[model samples]
Target: MTHVAIIGGGPGGYEAALVAAQLGAQVTLVDSDGIGGSAVLTDCVPSKTLIATAEVMADLEVADELGITVHDAEGDVAKRTTVDLGKVNRRVLSLARAQSHDIAERLDRDGIRRVAGRGRLDGTRSVVATLDDGSEERIEADTVLVATGAAPRTLPTAQPDGERILTWEQVYDLEERPEHLIVVGSGVTGAEFAGAYNALGLEVTLVSSRDRVLPGEDPDAAEVLEEVFKRRGMTVLGKSRMASVTRDGDRVTVALEDGREVVGSHCLLALGSVPNTADMGLEEAGVTLGKGGFIEVDRVSRTSVQGVYAAGDCTGVFMLASVAAMQGRIAMWHALGDAVSPLDLSIVSSNVFTAPEIATVGCSQKAVDEGEIEVEQVMLPLATNARAKMQGVQEGFVKMFCRPGTGIVVGGVVVAPRASELIHALSIAVAEKLTVDDLALTFTVYPSMSGSVAEAARRLHHVR
Candidate 1:
């Protein structure tokens, strides 16, 4: 059997290990962080879980409007809804650890040998893993996969002290809610945390270097989220670049380049992340390093060296867990001689778990505006949807793109509550190259949020 040695235990690493094992290859998984990687143990899972709790709190704020209210023993309607942050955080961490353990069990069942240590490429065909006990283990392999994930990016001017000033990972350790939260960055991570805290009834300030929040996402969706943030009494500082973040006692202060200052009880830095690829012997083993020290790999996850592959955040290709997993599987299939298709990012669906989550798949407006592709587009407001009206969701819309002539659906964007779930059908249509008529004719439950998707698709027919 072909021996495969994989490094890093994140989605990319663990997923690849499972694939190699199932392919009848002797797989050795070298992991340092737990089995599910940062995506499970720290990043994706934990943040989303926290957001889920925050969403419940947000919904409670509108409970009275829906004729739902808590009655006290004195027969008075109770207006207080408070979250025990300590309890919520404990639950988040518990769920993450449980998932990591489940992945470990699955790997063991697949008969993959796991080394709980830090691993690096010794060469194209071998790996040297340093165990936790200061012992080194060398493993020979027919193929090697590097899936070392990434760490939260920190700037010299803005350092996380893990207390009053914190990183996203450190927030869950807090036992009490902050009186005021100042989130720096205004990207997906920043917007998400800021929105969640605001929904939880805390004073939130979002610092954005750009004119609007979510500068990298769909502009329309960003506008909706920004408006909601403002409507909920959250302060959004636009065009303000963070100069320095300093903490003196319990107070955290952010100094902006424009000579402005913002103070809060706590600060969360969401400045993005850096790949954990340094001092890993990748370049020494002839692996090419790209901008920001990420491993340079192609669609098939092949590095510069033969028999060597890289996937996930270390590859700097999307830095999303789902994409990382797909890259890992593609790498294994190609390495093990299984019929393999290269990674197609266009059809890859993504979601930002802010209130009224933003989810999109396939083509984008930037592509259309730049004249890269010719396609007709349609957008429908969610407010017009019967379910959205009944649910009292006033913000968000469904937008779609399709070829004008062929009428084949190419892309879609959904900005609504659970847009993540609503985008799955659009993802399938884009992946299968289905026509707009396919979605328009697809049966959807009446008075549902998903009906907006069909309505959007049907409008695309008229646009063509």
Candidate 2:
């Protein structure tokens, strides 16, 4: 039987370990942290769990806007509601830890051995794991999968103290709610947390070096998010680059490059992530790294060295958990000599988890702007939808892009509550290369938010 060693117990490593084990390989999974990786134990799952509670708070706050009467503690009429932060944080952390434990259990049941320690490569086929008890073990493997993943990037000027200044991962340890949350980035993670905290009744200020929030996303989506954030009382400081962060007593302050200062109870740096590829013997094994220290891998997740492969965040792919999972599966199938297909990013749908979440797939407006793809487009506002009006959703839209002659959907965007789930239909359409007419012809339930998606597709039929 072939022996396989997978490093980092996140989605990529754990998923590949299971697949390799099922393929009759003896698998050993090594992780310095808990299973489920950063995505589960810290980032994606925990953040989204927190957002769920914030979403509920948003609904409660909007009751007054919907012309529904709300009562205050003294039994007087109230407009907006307050949030219990401690309760929300507890729920978020509880779910995250439970998920981590469950994944570890599943791996153990699969007969995969788990080594809790830092794992490094001695060679292409030899893995050296330093255990928590300070012992070391060398395991020989025919195939090695590297899924070491990434961590939140910190700068020398604004390093997190894990107290006042915080990374996204460190925010869960917060017991008391932030009086004012000064978020220092306008990327997806920053935007999501900013929106969530704003909805949860915190004084929120989102600092953006770009013109608006979600600068990396579709322009239309970004514009809508900015408008919504402003409407919700979030002070968006645009075109403002942060120079440094400092703390005074209990309050924190962010110094801007333009000589302005913003202060808050706490600050979160959602700058970006750096791949965990250093000192892992990647160079010794002849595995190459890209310009940014990302493991250089092909579509099949093969590294430069033979019998060595890498996947997930470490490979510097799209950096989504879904993409990571797909990459892991592809790696296993390719390495095991099974029927395998190369990674297809064309139809890989992605979403930014914010209030009125943004979801998109395929050809983007940026691609079109750069003269990379020729396409027709249509955009429709959700405010006009019957269901949206009833639900008091006044912000958001659905947009579609398609080839002019073929009418096949190349890409699309959905901006609304639960856009993450609504984007799946569009994802399917893009994946199947279905035309606008095909989507328009499909039946959508009336008085539903999804009907707006079909209407957007229908508008493409009348485009000039």
Candidate 3:
């Protein structure tokens, strides 16, 4: 039987082990962190759980319009809605731990050897695992997969003290709600946290170095979210670059490059991530490293070495959990000589979990603006949708792009409640290369947000 050595137990590593084992390979997974890695233990799962709690609070804000109201012991209407963050944090951590344990059980059932140690490539075909006791285990395999993942990026000037100043991963340890939160980034992570906390009844201030929040996302979507943030009483400081973060007692202060300062009860540094690839003997084994120490891999997840492959955040390809899993699966299929297709990032759908979420797949508005891809487009505001109005959702829209002549769907963007769920149909359209006519003819539940998706596609059909 072929032996597969996998490093790190994130989605990329564990998912690969399952596929390799099912394909009749002996798999030894060297995962120093618990099963599911940061995606489950701290980053994705935990943050999304917290965001779910925030969504509930946001819904209550529109309760009056929905003919709903909360009552106190005396049967009087309650004016303020508050969240028990202590309870919410506990629940978030519990769910994360449960998911990690579930992944562990699955891997055990597959008969994959799990090691609790740090692993690094010793050469082209060997992995060296350093256990907690300082002992080492050398794993020899026909193929090796590097999926060590990444850590929250921090700087010397804006270090997280894990208390008043914290990284996104450290926020779960908090037992109480903060008086004010200063999120020092306006990207996905920063915007999510700011929106979540603001919805949860905390004063929030989002600091952005750029002209607007979510500079990486669609401009119209970003504009809607920023407007919602301001309407919800959250302070958004755009064009303000962060210089440093310092905590003085219970209060934290954020210093901007312009010498201005903002004080808050706590600070969150969403400065992005750095791939965990150093000291891993990757280069020593002839594997190439890209900018920021990320592993350099091809479409099939192959490293420079013949038998070595890499995936996940370590590769810095999209930095998304779903993409990581796809990369790992592709790696195993290719390594095992099975029928394999290269990773197609264009068809992959991604979402920002902020209230009034932003989801996108395939082509981007930037590509069209820069004349990278030519297409006909249609955008329909959710406010005009019957379901959106019924649900008191006034923000967000559905936009679709298609070939001018063939009318084939190339991309789409949905910015609305549960946009993540709504983007899947469009993802299929893009993947299958379905034309606007195909989507327009499809049935979408009437008086639903999905109707707007189909309606937009219908409008695009007229381009031909």
Candidate 4:
């Protein structure tokens, strides 16, 4: 029987542990944090939960435009706007903790041993874990999986005290709503948080080093988001990089690279993530690391060392939970000598949980624009969409990319509420290698947001 030791309890580690255990491998999971890792307990779940409240706030704000009115308890016009940050924080933390406990319970039920500690590899086949009680336990394993996830990268100038200048994960602990939020970095995380906080009635300023928001996403999508943010009364400072963040009594000031300054109640550093690959004896084991400090892994999730593997954010392969889970499963399958296929990123769908969520899969406009891929593209505005018009949604678009010759649907992007759910169909099509003709023939309900998706695919049918 193979004994497997999995490091980190994030999506990658837990998923791999489950698969290995089911494959009859004795698995021991070592985690310094909670069972669900940062993705569940801190970053992804908490932020999305907070965004849920922000979404409700956004809907209420738009109710007046939708010919809807609410009366207060006294039967007068509803003129009050308030946010119970305490309640919101309570609910968010409660949900996160519940989910974490559920995961831990499931792992225990599956017969996988969970060790609460920081783990380090002593050798190729041995792991040493320092327990919470200051005791160290060494375990021998036939295989070791390093899923140690990443953390938010902080700047020397803009340090996170975890109170005022915070990381994305730390903001969930706030008892009071920020009067103004200055989010540094205009990447996906930064943009999403900025949009969410703006929806929640905080004066938001998105400081970006680039000329536009979402610098790495589709240009068209970024353009649309920038426009929407402006319309929503957000202050977007382009080409404005954060030099440092300083707190003065109650107010926090962000000094920009260009000498311009902005003040806010709190500042968030959404700069980027650094892989948790340090002090793990990876160097001694001869496991290679990439230039960016992530583990060097192939599609099969194998590091350079024998009987060892790595996955998730540590592998630097998209840093998404879904992708991490897939990679973990694949690693287990391969290690157990079962039927295994290499990781395929082509059809993997991802989403930014912003106000108008950005969900996408397969090829992108940047790829097409750079002539990296030969594809025909079609972009359809949600304002013209029947369901969108009826729902008073004026900002969003569904864009599709197809093979120019065969009209095979290669990729797509959806920017609107619940786009995350809607993109699954597109993901299936891309993964199944279905053509635009196939998508056009598929039935989508009329007077629905998804109708725009079908129509966008249908329009790509004529590009040949």
Candidate 5:
């Protein structure tokens, strides 16, 4: 049987281990964090759990409009609810730990050896793990999969103190809710946290270097989210680049590049990520690294060195957990002599976890605008949908893009509550190369957010 050594233990690493084990390969997974890595132990699972709590708080804000009244012990109407940060954080951590344990159990059942250590490439086909007990173990493998993932990018002028100033991962340790939260960077991570805190009834200031939040997402979706944020009393500082962050006693002040300063009780830096590829002996093993120390891997997740594969954030792919897992699986399948398809990034679905979440698949408006791909498009407002109206959702829309003549659905975007769920249909359409007419003809439940997806496709079909 082939022997496979996987490093990192994130979605990419663990998923590959599972696949390799199932394919009759002896798999060894080396991890510094828990089996689930940062995605479960620190980042994705924790943040999404926090957002779920924030969603509840946001939903309560419109309870009265839905004819639901909440009252206190004295039978008096309660104007607002309070957020218990301590409880919320405990729950988040508990959920994260539970998920990590679950992943560990799964790995155990699959007979994949799990090592708690930091792994580095000893050579092209060897992994040296430095265990917590100060012992080192060397393992020989036919294939090595590196999925070390990424860390929060920090600036020299703005270092995270982990108290007054924080990274996305450190936010779960906050025992008290910040009175005024200042989030630097308008990327997906920053926007999600800013919106979550605002929904939880905190004064939030989002510092954006770009003209709007989510500069990388759909323009219309970003615009709608910005509007919703502003409407919910979030202070958005556009075109304001943060130069430095300094803490004074209990307050933290963010200095902008343009000579402006904003002070808050707490600050969060979400300025993207840096791959965790350094000191891993990758270059020594003949692995190629690109700018920002990201491992250079092809669609099949193969590194420059033969039998060396890299996946996840370390590879500088889409940075989504799903993409990372898919890459890892592809690597194992290809290395194990199984038929596999190279990754096609265009069909991948991604979502930003904010109020009125933004989800997208396949071609984007930016591509169309850049003349990268010509396509017919149609955007349908969710407000016109019967279910959206019933749910009192006034913001968001579904947009679809298809080839001009063939009408094949190329891309789509959904900005609505649970947009993540609604994007799956469009993702399938894009992945299968289903035409707009095909999507339009598909049955959809009435009075549903998914109906807007079909409606947009139906409209695109007619526009052709």
Candidate 6:
């Protein structure tokens, strides 16, 4: 049996371990930060769980619109609801820990050896793990999968004190919500947190270095979100680069490069991420390191060295946990002599867990604009959908892109509540190369937000 060694315990590492073990390979997973890595332990799971609570808060805000009144202890109608930060944080951490425990249990059931340590490549086919007890163990493997994930990037001029200023992972430790929260960076992380805090009834100021929030996403979707944010009284500082963040007593201030400063009760830096690839002996083992210190891997997850692979954030590919899991599985299939398909990023679906979430799959608008791919497009407003109207959702839309000649769905985007779930059918269409007509003919439940997806496809079908 092939012996597989996976370093790091994130989605990429754990997922690969399971596939390797199931394929009759002896698998050993070495991790220092528990079995779920940052995803389950701190980043993805914790953040999303917190967002779930924030989502409920947002729903309650519209209860009156739905003719639902919340009564207080005195039998008077309550004008607003309040959040208990301590309780919310406890629930978030609890859910994250529960998920990590479950993942560990699954790995144990699969008979995959779990080593508690920091692992590094000793050579092309060897892993040396330094345990917490100051002992070391060496494992011989036929294949090595490196899935060390990433951490939040910090700037020298604006450092996190872990008190008034915090990283995305550190936010869960807050026992009190800020009166005015200033979020630096306008990427997915920044946007999601700003939106969540705003929904939770906290005053928020979003500092964006770019002209718009979520510059990497669809412009139309970003525009809609920005409009909603501004409408809801979020102070969006567009085209404003943060020079530094300093805390004076209880007040934290963010200084912009343009000589303007914004003060808040707390600050969050969501600039980007830095891969955890230092001192791993990767280059010594003939695994090439690319720009920003990310591991260089091919479509099948192989590094430059034979029998060595890298996946997930360390590879600098799409940072989504789903993509990381897929890369890990692909690496195992290839290493174990099983049939394997290279990673196709275009079909990977991703969602930004903000209010009126933005989800997308396949080719993006930038590609079309750059003449990289020609396609027909149709966008339908969700406001026209019966269910959206019933739910009092006035924002969001569904947009579809298809080949002009063949009508094959190439890409699609959804902007609505639970857009993440709504993008699955479109993801399947893009993955299977299904035509717009095929999507249009598929049965959809009436009075549903998903109906907008079919409607958009139907319009695209007619355009071709």
* Candidates' RMSD to native: 2.1, 2.0, 1.9, 2.2, 2.0, 2.0
Q: Which stretches of candidate 3 lie over 4 Å from their true place?
A: 71-80
- RMSD score of candidate 5 (Å): 2.0
User: Which is the winner by lDDT between candidate 2 and candidate 6?
Assistant: 6
lDDT of the candidates, in the order given: 0.92, 0.90, 0.93, 0.89, 0.93, 0.93
Taking all chains together, the TM-score of candidate 4 against the true structure is 0.96
lDDT of 1 by residue, 11-50 (tens): 9999999999989999999998889999999999999999
Q: lDDT tens string, model 3, 170-267?
A: 99999998999999999999999999999888899999999999999999899999999999889999999999998889989999999999999999
Each candidate's TM vs. the true structure?
0.97, 0.96, 0.97, 0.96, 0.97, 0.97
Off by over 4 Å in 4: 70-79, 462-464
Clashing pairs in 1: none
For candidate 1, the clash count comes to 0
Model 4 clash tally? 0
Per-residue CA lDDT of candidate 6, range 1-464, in tens? 78999999999999999999989999999999988899998899999998998888767656668988764666333234678887999999999999999999999999999999999999899999999999999999999999999999999988999989999989999999798999999999999999999888889999999999999999999999999889877999999999999999999999999999999999999999999999999999989999999998999999999999998999999999998999999999999988999999989999999988999999998898999999999889997999998998879999999998899999999999999999999999999999989999999999899999999988877553
**Pairs of colliding residues, candidate 6:** none
What's the TM for model 2?
0.96
Which of the two, 2 or 6, has more TM-score? 6
